[model samples]
Target: MSEQKKAEKIVGVKGMNDILPADAPLWELFENTVHSVLKSYGFQQIRTPIVEPTALFARGLGAVTDIVEKEMYSFTDSMNGDQLTLRPENTAGVVRAALEHNLTYDGPKRLWYVGPMFRHERPQRGRYRQFHQVGAEAVGFTGPDVDAELIMMCQRLWDDLGLSDIRLELNSIGNAEERNKHRVDLIAYFEQHKELLDTDAQRRLHANPLRILDTKNPTMQEMVNAAPKLLDYLGEESRAHFEGVQKILNHNNIPFTINPRLVRGMDYYNRTVFEWVTDQLGSQGTVCGGGRYDPLIEMFGGKPTPACGFAMGVERILELMKASGEQYAPNQCDVYVVHQGEAAQLQSFVLAERLRTAGLDVVLHCASANGGGSFKAQMKRADGSGAAFAVIIGEDEVTANTAVVKHLRAEEGAEQNQVSVEFDAVVDYVVDQIVGHGHDHDHDHDHVHYHP
Candidate 1:
C-alpha cells in the first residue's frame, strides 16, 4: 500500500486578525462614516507604501523610541541589499512622501489615509501586531486653531459613531528647548530616587526620561507622578500655543482634562499633544492619539512646515461600538433570482443582469450538481439572502417568456403577493415594486441580452 500523506496545517500569524464577512458590515459603516466626516472637513485621501527605508523612521521617529528601537520589522532587501522596514506608524511615511513630492511647495494641504500598521508587541483585547489606523494630517498649519480643529474633528467622529465613553486628555510637551530643560530636571529627579525606580524606569532614566512618566507599574506610580512635569517648563511661546488650543476647545464646549503625564511615545511630537482615551477597554485605553509635529517636514529635507494630525485604532473603535451595543446591519438585496432547467437558468442570468443595469442589487442562484435542488430548497436560499423579492423563472415561464415576482418581505397584514411579468418588463416591474417608484421602460422589447 502507498504511504499515507500527512496534511500540513497552516494558520495566520499570531496577533493578526481576519475580518470575516459577518464582521465586514460594521467595518464598512465605520469607514463610510469616517470618509464622510473627512470629506466635510475638506480632507483628501492620500496613500503611501507600506515599506519604507529603515532610516526614514529612525530619523523621523527618533532612534530611541520603542517603535524604532524595539518594535520595527526591519530587514535588508534581497535584491539590492538596502535596509527596509514595514511602517510601524503612517505619519513618518506621509511626511516623507510630502517632502519627496514637495506637496506643500505651493501651499499647505489636508490629507487623510486609512491602512494597516505593524508593531511587534504583546497582543491584547484591542491591540494587535497588524492593526489598522485612520489618520488625518493638516500640513503647513501653524496656529493653535489647527490643533483645536483636529481635536474637534475627533469629537465629531465619536459623536457620529454614538460613542460616549471616550474622553479627551490634553497636554503640551513644549518645544525642544523647553523639553530639554524639563528632561534635565526630570532625569535628576529620577536619579535622586534611583532606588525607587523600576527596571523599566531605570533603563529609560537617561535614554528617554519623559517616557518614564508614562509607566503603568503600580509600584513606580508615585515616583512617576512626582517626576517633573513638562508643563512646568513650557516656554513663553509654547505656553501661549497650548493655552490658545485650550481656549478654542473651551469655546467649542469640548470637555477635556489636562494630563501632565500624557507624554506620547513618538519623538517628533512637540507642543499640543492629546489623546482620546476610554475606560471601556481596560489596559488598552488610548483609542486615538496625535499632536502637532512642527519639525517633521523639515526633518525630512523639506522646507520648514508645521503639521498636526491624529490617528484612531479601527479595531479598538469597533470594539467600543460593539460594547456600546451599536447596530449596523448591511443593506439587503433588492431581488434574488431563483431558476430551474437549462433555458430557465439562462433566462434568469439575463434578467438578473437587466435588473442590475437598472440600479438594483441582484443575486442569481446557480443550479446544484444534482440538476439543482427542489424548488423548496431554492426558495429557502432566496429567503436566506435577505431579499425583498424573489424572481422565479421556471420551465413554463421560460417558454412563455415571462417571470413570477414574489414579494419575500412585506409589512404586517400586507398581502405577500406574486405577479406574472413579461420577460422584457421584469426589470421595470421589480424596480417599481421594490423601490416604490416607476421607471420609463423605453428599451426595445425583443432584445434578451445576457451579461455573462
Candidate 2:
C-alpha cells in the first residue's frame, strides 16, 4: 500500500497576529497609559460590536473611499441575507451605537474605546489586516474648544508615553457649503492639470477631490501643491471656528502647522481636522488622526449633535516606543515553592496558598511522575522563574513545621543566604523580605502588566 499523505500545518491568518507572552507587557503599558490619560479628562469607556451593517460605513465614510470600496471585510449573512462587515474603522459603529441607545439625548458625552479593527489591506510594518486602535469621541458639542481639548489630550498622551518625535498637523475643511465651493475650484484645477494626475489622483478627482491634495506621487506633487486651498474658501463662521481652535492651541503652547493638504480620508470630517504625524515610520507616518464630524450623528437619524474625535494606531505607537528604547519588563512572582515527597508536596501547596493570601505571588512546583526530579533541578527552575526567594519543603521540614527559605535574587555584594522559618511565620518572612526590605522582587510597576 502507498504511504498516506500528510496534512498541511495550520497557522494564523495573514496579517492577523497573536500577542505572545514576551510582547504582551509592552501592549499592556500602552493600554494603561491611554486609560489613565482618558480618565484624567473625564472620558468614559464605550464598547461597540466588531461587526455592523455594511451601510453604516458606506454612509459614514463615502462609498468611493478606499476602506469601503476595497478594504472592508464584508459578507452576506447566510441566515437572514443581511449585509454585514467587520469594522475597518470604529467611528461609524460608535456613532451607530450612540444613536441607537440615545446616549447623547440628555447632554454631551466623552467616550473612548480600545479594541481590534479589521481591514483587508496589504500588510506592512505598521499596517495590518487585523490591528488595534485607541479612540476618543466627544459627542453633542459644537464648539472649537472641544476640538482643541481633544488635540491637547493627545499631546498629553504623547508626553506621558515619553514620545518626543511626533508633531501636530492641523487644518480646516470648513462646512459643507464652503467645501462645495472649494471642491468646484479643486475639480477645475485637477481638470486643468489632467495630464499630470496619476491613476489614483484621477480616480479620486470627481469622487473625492479633496483627497487628491494628499497624494504622494512624486510627478503630481507640483500640481497637487498648486491646487485650490480649502483655507482660502473658509467663510466668516468657519474661519472664526478655525481661528478659535488655533487660538486655544497656541495659548496652551501646543505648536502646530496649518497644512492645507492635510485633508483626512473620511467623508464625515468637517470644519477642523488634525493629525499627529512622525518621521520614524516609513510611508505610514500618521500615527493618530481625527477631526470634527458634526453632521454624522444627524445623518445617522439621531437629533442633530455636534461631535469630534480621534484614533491612534496602537501597533504604530508601540513600534515607536520600542524604537525609543522604552522597556517593559515582564512581571515575575516573589516566591517559588519547591517540594519533595508526598507529605512535603501537600505542605508546599498549602503554604503557597498562604503566601498568596498575604499579598504575595507564589509559584508552587508540582510533583512529576519521574520521582519529582532532583533538588538541584527544582532549585534551577525556581531561579529561572525570576523569584527573589525560594521556599524549600522536604520530609524533615514538613515534620518540623518549618521551611528552608533561600534568597535567590540578591543585591550586589550581598551574600546569598538560606534561613529556617516556621510554617506559621513563612508568609510574614516572605512579605517582609520582598516588600519591606525593598528587594524589588515583586514585578509591580505603576503601569499595567500584560497577562497571557
Candidate 3:
C-alpha cells in the first residue's frame, strides 16, 4: 500500500495560541490579582476598539519602529477605503478613544485594560503575535507623585505575585525641545560612523534618530556609547522633574537603576521611561515596560493631557512562575455533582443550580445508566479536576431526598466521609460547610451581567 499523508488541521495562527484549561487557571489568577490591585490604587477600566485606523499606530507608535514598519497587521477594510489595523499596543488606541469620547475633558481619567494585542513576530515561550496585556494609565496628571505612584503600583503588583528577582531600570528622556536637541546630536554623532551601523539603524537615523541609540548591533552599540547622555540635555524643568521622581522612589524605598540608554520601543513615550526585567527568564527578558506620553493626547485631537502607564505581559509572568517554582494554586470548587439515572440527573441539575446561586463554582456531570464505571474511575476524575469534594447522587440517594458529598482528598484506604443533607437545605448547608458561613446569614443576591 502507498504511504498515506495525514490531513493537516490548523489550530492557532502563527503568533496566536489557545490558552488551554490547564494554563487558563494561571491566567485567571494573574488577571484577577492585577485587577484587584489596580482597583485598590483607584484606577478604573477603559476598553477601546481592537480595530483602529492604521495611521494611529504609525504616528503614535512611530512609522520608523518595527511595530509599524514590520509587525503591524495592516489591511484595507472592504466596507470603507480607510485602512484598518489590529492594535499593536494599547496607548495610542486609548489616547484616540479618550479624544473621541472626550473622556479627559471633565477630569483626570485613571484607566486600565486587560486584552490581547496583535503583532507579527516569532512565537516564543513568552512573546507571541497575539499576546495579552494588563495595563493601567493615569492621564492629565503631570506631577512627580504620579510617576512615583505608578512605579509603586508596579512594585506592589510584582510583590503580590511573589515574583522576586526583578530589577527596575529607570530613565528620563526630557521634554520635547531637550529631546529634540538630543536627537539631533545623536544623529550627527552616528552619521560620522554610518558605515558601522546596521541597515535598520541607518534607516531610523534619518526618520527618528533617537531610535538609533537603541540599536542592539555590536557596532551600533559601540557608536551609541560615544553619544552624549540625556541628563546633560535635560532642560531646567526636565531635570527638576526627573529629580523629583527619583526622590519619591527613594522615599518609597524602591530600588532602581538609571539606564540612560533605556529608550522604549514605542515613539509616544517621553520624559520618564522605565522597564521591569528579570534575569530568571532567558534572553528575551523584559516583563513590563512603559513610560510617560504627554503629547499623545494632543496628537489625537484631545487637550494636551499628560499620561504615564505600564503594561505587563501575562504570558511572561506565567513563564516566570513556572520556572521559579512559585506555587500559584488555582481556585478550585469545593464540590462536584455526578449523577446517574433520569431522576438522579434531574436532582443533580437542581442541586448544581442551587449551589451556583449560593456563590460556588460547581461542575455537574451526567452519568449514563448503561452501567457507570467503578467508584475508582469517578474518584480519579474528581482528583484530576482538583476539586476538594464530589457530590454523587445515585438512584437510592435521589429517592431518599439526599446526596452524598465525598471528600476527594482523603488519604489512601481512609474511609470516605459522605454527608447526607436535606434536598431543600442543600445549598445553604453546603455553603456553610465550604465557606464557614451560617445558612441564615443575609447576603446580597443581585447578579451582574456583563455584555461583551
Candidate 4:
C-alpha cells in the first residue's frame, strides 16, 4: 500500500476579512447607532442585490472613471453569457432599483443601506477589497435643504458616537453645462504643462479632468493647484445652491471648510458636494462623501429626478471608534451556567432556558474543558467568559433544589457579588439584577435524577 499525499489547507480570500467574535461588539454598536439616527430622520431602509449588470457602472459612473477602468470585480456569466459585476459602489444600484420598481412614481423617498461593496484594489488599513459602507439617498429632492439635512444627519451621528476630531469639507461641482465649459479650459491649461502630469493624471486629463485636480502626487501639486478652479465657473443658479447649503449648515452650527478641489470619485454627483474627513486617520482620507446627483434618475432611463446621498466606510469609522479609547468589555453573555455531574447538568440546562425566557442571555457550560467533568474546570471557563454572573450547579445543589449564582467580574471574596437563590427563583433574581425586569413568573417543575 502507498501513502497518500495530503491536500493543502485553504483559507479566506485575500483582502476579505472575517469579523471575529472579539470585534463584533464594536460593529454592532456602530450599526445600532446608525440605524437609530437614520430612522429618527424618517429615512427607510432599502436593500439591493450585490451583483448587477456590467453596463450599470459603465453608464452610471462614467466609463472613463478609475473605478470602472481599474477596480471593479467584473466577469461574464458562463451559463447565460450575461456580463455581470459585483457592485463597486451602491448609489448606482440604489438608483437602478428605484427606477426598476418605480418607487418614486408617487413621490420622493428617503432611503439608506448598509452592506459590503466589492472592489479589486490593493487593501490597506481602513480600506479593503471587500469593504462595507453605510449610505443614504434622498431621491426626488431638488433643493439644497436635503443636502444640508444629510450633512447634519452625519454630524449628529458623529456626535452620538463621541467622535469630535472629524471635520467637514464642502464644495460645489455645478451642473453639467458649467463643468463642460470648465472641462475645455482645464484640458487646455493641463496641455500647456504636459510634462508635470502623472500617469493617472494624464490618463484622466481629457476624460475625467476634474479628478486630476484631486491627485495625491506631490510632483504635480504646483500645476494642479493653479488649474482652473470649478468654483470660478459656477453659474448664478449653481452658486446660489452652494450658498444655500452653506447657509443652512451655518444656521445649524455645523462648521465646514470649502475645499475648492474636493471633487468626489463618482461621476453622477452635481451641485452640492461635501465630505467628512478625519486627520486622525492616516493621510486624512474621507470618512464619508456625497453630493446632489439630479441627473442619475434620467441616466438610469427614468424621468429626470433629483437625488442626494452619502456613503461612509464602515472599517474606517470603526477604526476611528477604536482610537477614541471606548472600551468594549469582552461580553460573551449575561449569565454563564456551569455544572458538574449528570444531575447537575440537567438542572443547569433547565435553569439556562428559564433565564433566557426572562430576557437574559444565558450560556450553559458543556462538560468538555480539561477533565470534561470537573467543577473547577467549568468554573474557570465561566469566569473567563466575560459574563456578568455565573450560576454554578453541582450534585449537592441538584439534590437541595438550589443553585449558587456568583458574579464573575467582581473582586475576589466580595460576598456582595455572590448570592444563592432557590432553583425556582434563579431566573427572576438574575433578570432583576442584570436588567431590572418587571414581569413576574413562577416555576413548578419536577427535578431530574441520574442513576449509573
Per-candidate Cα lDDT values, in order, are 0.88, 0.90, 0.80, 0.87
Winner on lDDT between 3 and 4 is 4
lDDT of candidate 1 over 289-401, digit per residue (tens): 99999988888887888999999999999999999886777546778899888899889988888888776677898766765466888889888888878999999999999
Ten consecutive residues with minimal summed lDDT in candidate 4?
443-452
Clashing pairs in 2: none
For model 3, give the RMSD to the true fold: 4.5
Q: Candidate 2 regions off by >4 Å?
A: 1-7, 367-372, 412-416, 441-452
Worst 10 residues of 3 by lDDT: 443-452
How far is 41's C-alpha from truth in model 1 (Å)? 0.5
What TM-score, to 2 decimals, does candidate 1 have?
Answer: 0.94
Best by lDDT: 2
RMSDs, each prediction? 4.0, 3.4, 4.5, 4.8
TM-score per candidate, chains pooled: 0.94, 0.94, 0.89, 0.93
* Candidate 4 runs further than 4 Å off: 1-4, 369-372, 411-413, 435-452
Q: How high a TM-score does candidate 4 get?
A: 0.93
TM-score of 3: 0.89
Tens digits of per-residue lDDT for model 2 on 54-165?
Answer: 9999999989999998999999999999999999989998899988998887889999999999999999999999999999999988899999999999999999999999
- Candidate 3's C-alpha runs over 4 A off are 1-8, 367-376, 411-416, 436-452
Q: List the pairs of residues colliding in candidate 3.
A: none
